[model samples]
Target: MTPILLIEQVLNGLQSGIMLFLMAAGLTLIFGVMGLINLAHGSLYMIGAFAAAAVAGWTGSFTLALAAALAAAALAGCIIEMVVIRRLYDRDHLDQVLATFALILIFSEGTRWLFGSFPLYLDVPAALSGPVRLPGGILYPSYRLLIIVIGLLIAIGLFQLIARTRIGIQIRAGESDREMIGALGVDISRLYTIVFALGAALAGLAGALVGAIQSVQVGMGEPVLILAFVVIVIGGIGSIKGALVGALLVGLTDTLGGVLLPLFFGLFMDPSSATTIGSALASMSIYILMALVLLFRPTGLYGRA
Candidate 1:
């Protein structure tokens, strides 16, 4: 492959990874701070996409669409946390899983009921619809590049939020000792709701960002949810830093393996067989990477032992 093509793919991978980080960051934060296993997290993502789509269709403002996404998802998250998830904190993971899985179905059907089975499209804003030339004589979608920049900025913001803010300290403290934090006058329930909502909002933002590139439809978040899970697992269950690193690794491996494997096999075999085998193996590449990481570092790349 040409250097230009390879670089483009890498950029694509980076963009994908950044979106994944958006999803995984909230997930890691939620789990770390509240110790909740939220299977319905993907449903929140879908909700954000639908919210953005509906808002954009009505107002024709992409900015408003994003704000709608963030608001809808966060509000939904707060409602669920207060109504359903709050009760599940003392329950085991199996119960939490079953409950959240039910929430997923409810969300999917509810979305379909409201939005219909047809997919909605999110148009890139005019200002970002055009491509910009990169230094290596590369042309890439400005929207995608913006996604990367925005993701990175959010990442830095998250780091600062965790390190500098009073809320950040509370979140970290809550993670280590929830009961103790509550005893110290912190409203544990309020804190949990806030954390859950924040996580949901982040997931929604990811959905809105990605919806521009793809059809906004019911069930779109499930695939990304699976990848986010892999990201958290590989990065450690509660580590944002780990989530970012693991997401990039998974994103690059999945994207590049799909592209390179067939080419590599084609050099030694017939094209058709190469394509079939390469595609199959490429699909497994991320799982393989996850397994490799778990082999030696059972806690994950940045997980505490």
Candidate 2:
């Protein structure tokens, strides 16, 4: 209702968008570079959350938990790429989809077996457990602020890596033509593995970070995965900039719509009815935004023709 409350909601939206960017960035990277549709990317995200939760429970160190998440997810990604995904690269999209879909089931059941059906709680570190005062006397959760900062830092690092690093050139080449990259002695298979692992690591990082704010539970990644797919579709497959912009747009639209729509409708209707209608519309806002964007720019904002 108030401007301060609106600002807080905006910040929350930004944090949510940042997490989505983390998830979508990897997805776009994998599809862009490898031409593979990995339905199991969400599995990697779940693995990361479980890894972080388990390690945090044992060691009581958030830092170590994060490292464990990155290592576990990256290792899982490497293995999946080598043992299963490698063979599917040359196959059609249907085959890739089917195989990855199977991987999702396998990962979910395996995780449930290991972690059980109960959700694990990851406590925010003592250092970041409280709210911090911001400009205009607004206070926000320090952990969420950290998440936003970390996400933005990762985004910058990814941009630099793709634009300036040697591996980046090879990745771009692979995206353009895998055969040419192989002809150049760049070891296309190795590049693919590395890219997939990197993508998985990012997803895992997102899962670990968000796990603190939400429950770290089995099959936690599926819902986020759906949103991430919507993100990529809105942003354009394989476009990092588009992912960032689209994610922010989705996040802001979703959060603000939920908060604002009820108020807007309440102006002319009963509170209960307004709340019901607003919640329904808010839930569909991101998809509506996606459809509008696609209608105008099929390739998405920042996507190449």
Candidate lDDT (C-alpha), each: 0.94, 0.93
* Model 2 residue 61 distance off true place after TM-score fit, in angstroms: 0.4
Model 2 C-alpha RMSD vs. true structure (Å) is 0.9
Per residue, candidate 1 scores C-alpha lDDT tens digits across 1-305 of 99999999999999999999999998899888878889999999999999999999999999999999999999999999999999999999899999999999999999999889999978889999999999989999999999999999999999999889988999989878888999999988988999899999999999999999998999999999999999999999889899999999989999999999999999999999999999999999999999999998999999878
For model 1, what is the error of residue 194's alpha carbon versus the real structure, in angstroms, after optimal superposition?
A: 0.9
User: In candidate 2, where is summed lDDT lowest over 10 consecutive residues?
Assistant: 296-305
lDDT of 2 by residue, 173-282 (tens): 88788888899899888999999999999999999999988989988999999999999999988888889988898889989999999999999999999999999999
Cα deviation in Å at residue 305, candidate 2? 2.7
TM-score of 2: 0.98
RMSD of each: 0.9, 0.9
Best by lDDT: 1
Off by over 4 Å in 2: none
User: Mind sharing the TM-score for model 1?
Assistant: 0.98
